[model samples]
Target: MYTLLIVDDESIAVRGMKQGIVWSDLAITEILEAYNVKQAKQLFANHQIDIMICDIEMPGQNGIELLEWTRTHYPDTVSLFLTAHADFTYVQKALQLGSFDYILKPVKHEQLKDITGQAVLQWKKNEEKKTFSVLHKQYVQQWEEQLPHLIERFWQELLGERVLPKSKQIAAKLQQLNIPLTLDDQVLPILISIEMWKEEFNARDEEIMEYALRKTASELMLASWPGTVIQDRNGINLLLIYVKPTDPIIRDEVQKICEEYIRYCNQYFKCSLSCYIGESTKITEIPGMYSDLLVMERNNVSASNKVILANEQLQVRPFFDSSATSFPVMDWIMLFELGRKEELLEQMTESCTYMEQKSGFCKEDLESMHTSILFLLFSVFHKKGLSVYEAFPSKQLIDSTINIRTLEQFRTWMYKVISQGIGHFMLHAKEESEIVIKTKKYISEHIHQEFSREDIASYVFLNPSYLSRLFKKETGISLTDYILKERMNEAKRLLVQTEMKISQIAESLGYMNLSHFITMFKKVNGATPMNFRKKIQ
Candidate 1:
């Protein structure tokens, strides 16, 4: 419903028009009568007039002036002129004032009603347009608010191989996300590894402190450069600095900034962080550079609170001869037993890289590696109170150890077996007491089975209630939580390493209900099984 105002000099003219017109048929709910522009202005000030009909030659202010004022103040209201004269001058002036239509004096009620109906239709269209514009702006604002998160998600997918690494695809996604980056842009990946915290803190506290470190790095280290600091899935902070080819001194500048950031973190946050500066490459190569930096960080076992350049690490080659003397087997055993996997792997890689560079793999080199691995396996199993045969149940351990012919094959086998042995040993070693260790080992060994508190307690030879309390007191996590955590961790490993379907993975984790497994996975990882696989695979 709309309000209509009629203006004229004579009362009878206004009264006749107001009474004669069938306003209700045109959807006009209220009809206001005014003898002059002054009265019409007052009526307009009080009510929201949708349409106005006025006489052209009123005293003081004419219909042309009223139309001009209405057009300026309430442009949405449609105006029509009623006049005794059909003079060209009057009609021209009314049209110039933006009146909707010009009706002759002594107007027929039907003709006036038809014009009002048309005006009402136009008004409704304008209102709809206004509403649509408001809605469009609201949605645009919402998109802008969510743009940062979307960009982060896109980068996560790109880094995780969920999105293809082609330049065209990356550029298209950048445009869609409104990120001011392109395929041609040079991006340097700086891996920030938080080494040690001087203060004791819980998991949530550590997360908050890490977030603060990232924010500080963004503001203090890369303030002059355009970049973003993202925490990868492995909890490693990566700062991608976008540089131009013209900026030749950026690498040195970034190195200095990272050194300064390290000092600041040590001073203020009571934490030591290692910054691995990667070579600047095109945006499309960021994922590769990111992976390289992670490797570099892992190999940085002997250094902390320092800036290590990727170029320098790449340049490090084996300086010793592999055939001259065998590498220290006892040192490798010590590092492995100490759970220094990174240092162990780094030493092995350095030795192999040097050996391969010097004379390739010889019989002596193979014997030396085999001896060291055997020593490591024997010592590791002995400390855990297990024999070599018991440690490896699937195969004859000595037979596999004796069959290594090449350095490449030995290296592959070494990594697989060493990583598994260290992982298993560390899981049991984390429990402070023997009973807790037994409970943890049992949970790990039977992770695929649907076991309860009673089942685990029976396997560990303890009362269920006592075992639960002891496990919590020793490990700071309940037995049930420990089982779930182990299952989720295994699920993650399988998702990344294998091409098994989601349902199969869930079943392997002892989840009979696919939806329940997905819900639980999402609860732990913030992503479903399928999405998590996409992120890692």
Candidate 2:
């Protein structure tokens, strides 16, 4: 509903318009008439006029002057100029005065209806934009308020392997959450391993003290640089300092912080702990690096309030591997989970060959190797959420760890254990493979449609973000990267096998912009579509 004001020198002309046009059909509920600019100003002051249809030429004052005044005083009200003469000056000045439209004397009622209909649509759009602006501001404020919790949640997911930990994925998520870090950037991690509390405290009280220690570490250790103090699921507090990969002297400063941090914790918190600093590594490699630091911590059973630097010495060691990094426990766990059985066996055989060449390898060393292989089996089963009975149906398999008296026995035991473990993994992996196979099938069917992760997630009955994590965990590649690969593969096939134009192919593949399609094609295929076609021909 809107109000209208019609101003003209001729009362007959105004009356004629009032009678000719159906104001009710134009969404105008009330219409007012004014003979001159003064009367129009009075009407504008007293009434809520949404639109004004005014004649240009008047006896005392004209529509141009009235529109100029309306532009300053009531800017929301729109105007249209009406005149008998088609003078260039009238049209130019009418436009300069910000009138919605300039019309010659005789106008069709249907044309007027169309123009006013467009005007109402534009008005509604403008109102919607204003409302959107307010809503956008409100959302920004809420996101800022929740940013801390969001960052904490991101770290927890990343540590738990519930989020894809690739550079592009991490950077996009960080950008979406407005975090000030990139995954390509390197971070130096200091593992704060609390050995034992000197004073007795309940689990809840200890958790509170640990929280206080994390805050203290943030205030003291990270005061000089930008960093975060994160506590993992196991209640392991780690202070991650964001640094460049080429920044080699961070360890020097790390020593200073750890010395003070250790002293402060011992004196106030009444706990014995050690800070083991790792080399600067990319964000995607944080979990593996943190695991290595855990191995270093677990090996040092005698140290207390110490500042230990973990170099490549502990790189491939597992929690109970001691100093025997002969086999990469985590890497092998990753391989077994991905169902790479032959490669895993070959690697195990290679590790045994290397051990055979060494004269100092003894039963203790064999015990470390045994622990490493057992860790891989346990870790993979845990990740799949399977029971011990389901993983190893025979108690003999668990008890057989003690039968390994010599290198040959250890080798035999490992082969039997790994082969049995993989059998279970492959059976459960079929369930995961079903999901991956279903996802790939869905992507193949909708390659030409623009759909979101949420759309695919809903199809698979999973959460949107969780779908990406699951895909990456199972396939060793991000879901988005897999989709891009499929799209590019289809593009190559079309370019070589079909007679379609590049633009048509791009559009068929749901790429609206031809240049963007070319750029992406070049990025993926190392050649543009035209060049690819040329080579094919």
Best by TM-score: 1
Give all TM-scores, in the order shown. 0.60, 0.57
> Each candidate: how many clashes?
0, 0
- Best candidate, lDDT: 2
Q: For residues 1-537, write the lDDT of model 1, one tens digit per residue.
A: 899888889988888888877778888899888988888888988999988888999899888888888988888888888889889998998888777788997899888888878888888998999999999999999999988668767777767663256777788888998776767668788888776666534455667888999999989977888778887554557787777776643678888899999999999998877788988887776776776565455334356588988766432222222223467544565577678888888888888888888898787876666666766676445434344554465453456656777777778877877787787777765547666777778888888887666566556544344455556666777565567778889999989999888899989878889988887778778998888877775
Question: What is the C-alpha lDDT profile of model 2 across 30-72, one tens digit per residue?
Answer: 8899999988999988998887888999887788888889989
> Candidate 1: lDDT over CA atoms?
0.75
What's the alpha carbon RMSD for model 1? 16.0
lDDT of candidates 1 onward, in order: 0.75, 0.75
RMSD of each: 16.0, 24.3
> In model 1, what lDDT does residue 219 have?
95
